[model samples]
Target: MDHSIGEIALRAGVTVKAVRYYSDLGLLDSWRAPPGHRRYDEDAVGRLELIRRLRALGIDLPTVRAVLTGERTLSDVATARAEALAVQIRTLQLRQAVLRVVAQRPEEIHQMSDFTEFDDDRQALVTDFLDAVIGDDPELRGIRQTLTPELPDDAADHQVCAWLELAQMLPDAAFRATVRQMVADWRSDWRADDLRPGVVAALRQRVGPALAAAIDPASPEARAMVDEITADYARQLGKPADHELRTRLSSLLETAGDPRWFRYLRLLAAVNGWQDPEPLQPIYDWTRTALRHAG
Candidate 1:
């Protein structure tokens, strides 16, 4: 049976105006009844349904027309639409994460205001900011690699929160200077072999336990921890584990041990969905104190 535009629209779940528009766009074909009203056969209803489905899936009208004209298969149209929708979904998700964080801290809304226009390349802006803080120092290549934020397309709230927190720090001149100075000092000490890889491992492995135990930094056990680390440092420096070495080592840690860096590490872990090592600043502080009196 033939159906009028109104009846076909009701059956196809579209407005009469939409049916007329689709007909005008050659997306739907209809015949004129003798009474001069537009009429569609049953096949028209199916075509209209296909058009609705494609449009709902974010296919553009031109692409939908191509699908209707058999220039592309339904599968091809669907695949293209899926890819486009995926990009849009990611964009919306980023905006949603930004807006949620902004809503909670309305005072910081200005921080997110301009970001609304950012596309998926927004992560590049963050990387650029990090590069400015890190500079072109080749010694910090590893730290720079680790600190780079690569937010997953399907990032959860914690990851987004990590990004928001990190983004907030990018413009902080004090924070940038702290990290820059730490990197510079680390590089300077690196040349003299004052800071070495094994030293950090020893501190983390030996001093970490004492710090966790809350042992007094001036206690005998603290001295043992300091001795273990200094021994490791002395091996790296090819020097005796003397008071002078201990003093220099303690100063190195004190200068590089910014609590902000600890926070940065924590936030990076959150962004990467890694387990937190807990806070390391406390351990560094305790070890620095212990190193001073290890004599």
Candidate 2:
């Protein structure tokens, strides 16, 4: 079955000139009829549709002709297109990060080149910051890895923004000392040695609920909850549920709740593209209030 040039163009939803152009390029088939007018086979409609799609992807006539003539596999054409899109998407993300810095953090625009380059010196700065805070203990290797953020060469928009935010904090002496003290305080309690993660869980599992219920920290309800939490901490430490241990629990959770420390975890998660950790600031605040009013 054959179709006139007009019929083929109409069926393919293209201009007649578009169909003729492809035919002229030898990418589509057409023949002269007895009347010396061009006619296309029904297959030309399908081929014209393919040409439109391929051309829209920026494939030139020669490659499209090769695809149409079976000189190249459609898979090969698709792979090239997918790879090109990956590069384009990565570039767009970087452009978006720059735009955000200009629009939102105009004052910080001078720092744009740092993220753009992300050279070895920039990474060394991160390493030094981590070492000052987390230390070089062999046992802390896992903890160091978890806290450290490795910004990739082709980071996404949010990741680039995250690195920018984290970088801002890197040079702040007060913040660095705060984080360093947090690690020191944590390590002092041997929570890192025996029950670091467990202590955090104790706070979330117990203090989280009473705070949500708005229980007054000084009330018996709050005291009992605190007692149970301390006892849980004692069990993790293999210590007895005694007065000293109860006091230790208050101290334990108190140090863990610094607002700045919580922000670092969030920024770390963002930089590494991990699931944002649960918001524990409120829980830490609850613990702080509970301790303040426990008398």
Best of the candidates, TM-score: 1
Candidates' C-alpha lDDT: 0.77, 0.75
Judged by whole-model lDDT over C-alpha atoms, candidate 2 comes out at 0.75
* Global local distance difference test of model 1: 0.77
Q: Give the runs in model 1 whose Cα sits over 4 Å from its true position.
A: 1-16, 31-46, 91-104, 112-122, 133-145, 151-160, 181-198, 204-228, 239-248, 290-295
Model 2 RMSD in Å is 8.7
Residue pairs with backbone overlap in model 2: none
In candidate 1, what are the lDDT values of residues 45-140, reduced to their tens digit?
999999898788778999888888889898987887778778888878877777777677779777666544455445666777778778767767
Clash count, candidate 1: 0
| Predicted structure with the largest lDDT when compared to the true one | 1
lDDT of 1 at 229: 75
lDDT of 2 by residue, 1-295 (tens): 9989899888888898988888888878899998888998878788899999888888878888889888999899989989878767755666666676668768867776565553465678788888888889886789888888876645666777777788888878988877776677566745543236666777788877787788888788887777676666666778887766656655555556666777888888987889888878788777666655664
TM-scores, each model vs. reference: 0.72, 0.62
